[model samples]
Target: MKTPQIVELTSTDIDQYIDKLCTILHANVHDGASVNFIVPFSFDDAKNYWKNKIQSSIEKQERTLWAAFEGDNLAGSVQLDYSMPPNQNHRCEVSKLIVHPDFRRRGIARKLMAQIEDKARELKRQLITLDTVKGSKAEPLYLSLGFEIAGILPGFSRHPIENRFDATTYMYKNLAAKFDG
Candidate 1:
């Protein structure tokens, strides 16, 4: 299948995309996807969280949010945040690389990742760092994309309903060299 296109999330797209994202998050919360917030979170709460995300992205020095599209549907989303202080100007953090369950294994997440990496390079960010829930399907994908495992945080996350689970695997990708090109 041809790859879905990745585009910057616009003001109009944020609300609808967040709605779909909340749907995906709701499903995952039931099955346990260590994002943020405990399970049993309402869609309203998710919308509020994403609302802030959109605002933060609009800040010139904060973040850039990207949404993946398959035709007219919102397939997935990701973010590249550069809110580091003066000393850490060269670094950025990636977060919320999520795809709908029906859209998994279709290269949507990779495309989104690529989009953010491109933007990071344009923004002169040399290092990109992020963490994924341990044992999640995305971890291997990240490893394949050249991200190195920096460390693991044990019991760093707890599902309000799942009792307890391993924290997350912190990973870093040296994009400075790649950014130079």
Candidate 2:
């Protein structure tokens, strides 16, 4: 697969790519993503969630939405939540990192995350925080990318398939802003 381009999706782009985004999200949820949704994630549910949560947040400049595309096909996406108290303006939270099931193992998530971190640094944000289901695929990825596990919240959320609760791992990276000599 050719290297996919990352696009900062505006509302119009979100409207255009919402279907693909829902598809990827649905697949991830059903695949035990533990990303705030259960296994019966329907297209409508995902669409509504994105519209109300992501699109509005982006328009309000409280969040930044980015998508990865391969030849016009949406491959993956990640979000950065920059809205916070004034004193915490240098921090942001990374959330909703999802790649299409078919596009996994091809470094789609990695590329999206790299872009997220770069954008944070560009904005002079020195701290990035995120949480994922403990022991999920994402935990290792976050760790590999230099995020340290801050703590674990037991029963943070329930697993999609299992009725039992799953722990959540909160991680953070204190990025040093790049300075040009």
Candidate 3:
């Protein structure tokens, strides 16, 4: 299958992104994946969250939101936040990476990550960090992509349905040396 093409998501893209995020969140809960909420996530809440995220990103002017689309359908997404404190402005944080249930294992997330890295480099960011639920299938992917496990935080989150899940892995990579323009 052809991977979805990544595009920079602006405020105009919030509605579509929210729809996709709701799908992923519902699926994760259905699959018993420990993200948050339960199997029946409220689409309204998801929409509200994405709306805030988009507005915040725009206001901060230090974040980049990228969405992967197959034709007119959203397939996945990843966000890069570049608003570190003064001394840490060279670092970025990766967050809200989600792929549709039917779109897993086809490198969509990898492509998103790569695109975000390119954006980070373009902004002169020197490091990237993110937290993923422990035992997630994404752990291997991150490690394979050269992200080092900074550490693991235990009992970091509790799935409203899954009851309790242990740990969230923190990963980061130095992107400065890898920059090529």
Candidate 4:
């Protein structure tokens, strides 16, 4: 696949690409990605998630979403949420880094992450935190990108398709370290 062009998605863009975004989310969840969804996840469920949950956050400026596109096709997306408690203004959380299964191994997730990290730095956020299913493919990616494991929440969530529990690995990167010197 050609390299995807990454763009910060506005609420209007979300509305325009709503179906594609929903498709990406639905595909990932059905493929066993622990992305806050389970099997029997329908297209309507995905649509509601992006429209109700994510779109509102974007409109409120509490979160920023980025999408990776290969031509007109939506390859993947990631979100950086800066809406924290008053005392935690310098931190942001990375959530829902989803790539269409067909677009995996193309560095799309890494690109999405780089975009969000840059956005965080631009907004003066010092700490970036995220979590993924322990031992999943994403764990190694986060590590390679300089995120250190903060802790592991054993059985924190269930496997998307199975009835068994899965552990979650919380990881963080201190962007302030890069700016300190």
Off by over 4 Å in 1: 16-18, 59-61, 178-181
Model 1, 1-181: lDDT tens digits are 5468888866556665666767766655555666777866888877777776655565554777887778866777888888898988898999878787778889888888888889988997888899998888889999988899999988887864677766699998887655652
Of 2 and 3, the candidate ranking higher by TM-score: 2
The per-model lDDT (C-alpha) reads: 0.78, 0.89, 0.78, 0.94
List model 3 lDDT by residue over 94-152, tens digit each.
97777877788888999999998899889878889998888888899899998999999
Q: Which candidate order results from sorting by TM-score in descending order? A: 4, 2, 1, 3
Predictions: Cα RMSD each:
2.8, 2.9, 3.2, 1.8
Minimum summed lDDT over a 10-residue window in model 3 is located at 31-40
In model 2, how large is the Cα lDDT of residue 91? Answer: 90
Q: Write the per-residue lDDT of candidate 4 for residues 15-53, one digit (tens) a residue.
A: 899999999999999899999898899999998999999
Q: Which ten residues in a row have the lowest lDDT in candidate 2?
A: 172-181
lDDT of 2 by residue, 1-181 (tens): 7898998988777888888989888988888887789867789999998888888888898888889999978889999999989988879999899998888898888999999999998888989999998898899999999999999999989888779999999999989655231
Better of 1 and 4 by TM-score: 4
TM-score of 4: 0.97
State which candidate, 2 or 3, has the greater lDDT.
2
Cα RMSD (Å) between model 2 and the true structure? 2.9
For all predicted structures, in order, the TM-scores are 0.88, 0.93, 0.87, 0.97
User: After best superposition, candidate 4 residue 20: deviation in angstroms?
Assistant: 0.1
Worst 10 residues of 4 by lDDT: 172-181
